[model samples]
Target: MRGMKSRLLTRREMDDLITKPDLPSLIADLENTPYREYIIGAKGRLDGILCIEAALRDNFTNTFRKVQDFVRQEEAERYIVIFLHRWDVQNIKTILRGKNIHVTSEEIASCLVPAGEMDEATLNELLKQPDVRAVVDLLATWKIPYARPLTRAYPEFLKTKDLAVLECALDRYYYDDALASVNSPGYNNQIIQDILRLEVDVINIKTVLRMVRDRVDPEEARRYLIGGGRVFDERKLGSMLCLSSIEDVVKTLANTPYRFLADLPESSIRSQKISIIEKELERFLIRKGVGAFRLEPLSVASVIGYFWAKYNEVTNIRVISRCKTADVSPDILKEELVYV
Candidate 1:
């Protein structure tokens, strides 16, 4: 783990790429790093954001495979599995959305990242489903575990025709299953627990904040709140949903470990720029994970930390590529990126 961590890009390397004058220069700079081979393969075939996304998917998936090789223990493998489960959830969500809109198989397949337990073949099969309900039914036929949540959420989907309800169910289910996997009696899964809880906390915070900004009913928003956050339990999250404003929400969090969220620019919130807060919260989680990585050295925390840092790099590169293609200003690009 130590040697592998050493090989990971330093903050300086990310800065060098970030400061590139244009998309071509950024792509060129990436060719000198671990992303080289992936970028090379994608060079002529794809351009702009598509090229960057392809390379990143390849890089991340390949790196995860390496982590699997590095960690031979069953417990460590389970941790990696749980970490990768998000990709499965995300892929399923993408397919559902595509099916809902009646997109063709090729279009749906293009949007998927086979970075989880689900392979390309399985995802392609999923693309064959006629609608979202059929997709859910397909999962059950395949005996995939995610089927349970999607199945349960299906009735609500039929009733309200709201994808958010179904998506929330899947999100909560993923967290519940993930926590259960790691929270075995007397296991040294504290770091895993902490990371997952922090994620839950962030998700809950974002949900509450969005509800406030969008004027969603407080009681209704409470259903989307996932349990098991280190802070912001059921009662607290409900309380937060009832808050009148982003400022009040931040103030409410002032006494919690997530007080840093209060530092989010209030002006942005006032101007309906809730995305800024969401972006900041994402960076905050990555930064916290990276800190744990450094503090814990060769432990699982470091591995998870490296995972986040690498993911952030991919995301930043993708942002730079797309922004450059769109001729977006450098200042705005910088604000969109997460540099720690």
Candidate 2:
């Protein structure tokens, strides 16, 4: 962890990258940073967003490699793998989406990030399947746990042709698996569990808000409600599902530990500009992770916090580069970013 901390980019470095005038400038700046080798490799082979994505993927691969290589504690390595599984879930979801749309294998391969358990070759093989169902079947054939939720969601996906059902099932399975993995009785593991629980809360809150906004039936909306949040158990989420409006949901949330959510503008939520709420939630999570890092410098919390910080930095740069390419004003892009 001590060695990993020094490798992480400082706030100033992130600021410098964020303020780059254009995508090419950003790529140029990356050449002088830890991503220099990836930048060099991507030169001429890729450009613009593709280049950035490739560099980020390579950077992610190296980040985990460095952590696992440096950390002597077997426990720390286990937690890191658990943390990285989210990307595995993401890669699978991307493949599923591509399969749903009948995209070519190359097109599907371009979107994958081999930052998790499944390597690039495995994901590419999954892409070669004839359809999304075959992809889901492949997971079962491989004895992967993700196949269960995906299989359960497949019939509904076929009936409704709504990918959200499948996506939600994936989310539920991922969080459930994450929470179970970290549920062992201990203080450091408890910290990781809390961070994950907060994540589950944010997902549940957003799901409920979107459902209310879309006028989804309460019973139908509850299907997306995930358990394991600190503030929201099955019963509490059920109660929330009974709320008539986003305003009511906000009021209900104000009585809970996540009262910070009340700070979000009800009008913005009603207007469907929920990005503000999402950003605030991310800021809240980042702040909590940082706090845990300070309180437990030698513990897994430090790695978790540094990971979130780096994750946010990467996300900010990606958003800035993409927005700059689209000629979005710097002020608007900065405003959308969470800087904890």
Instruction: Please give each candidate's TM-score.
Output: 0.93, 0.93
Q: Please provide, for model 2 over 1-340, each residue's C-alpha lDDT reduced to its tens digit, 9 standing for 90 to 100.
A: 6565676667687778767888889889988887789888877698888888888878877787777677657666667887678888999999988988888888878777788888888898898899888999999999988899999999999999988898899988888888888788987788888888888888888888788767788888888888888888888787787777777777887777778878776688667676677777778877776566675677787778777766776677678778878888767777767676
Report the Cα lDDT for candidate 2.
0.81
Candidate lDDT scores, in order, read: 0.82, 0.81
Residue 224 lDDT, candidate 2, scale 0-100: 80
Error of 2 at 118 (Å): 0.4
- Which residue pairs overlap in candidate 2's backbone? none
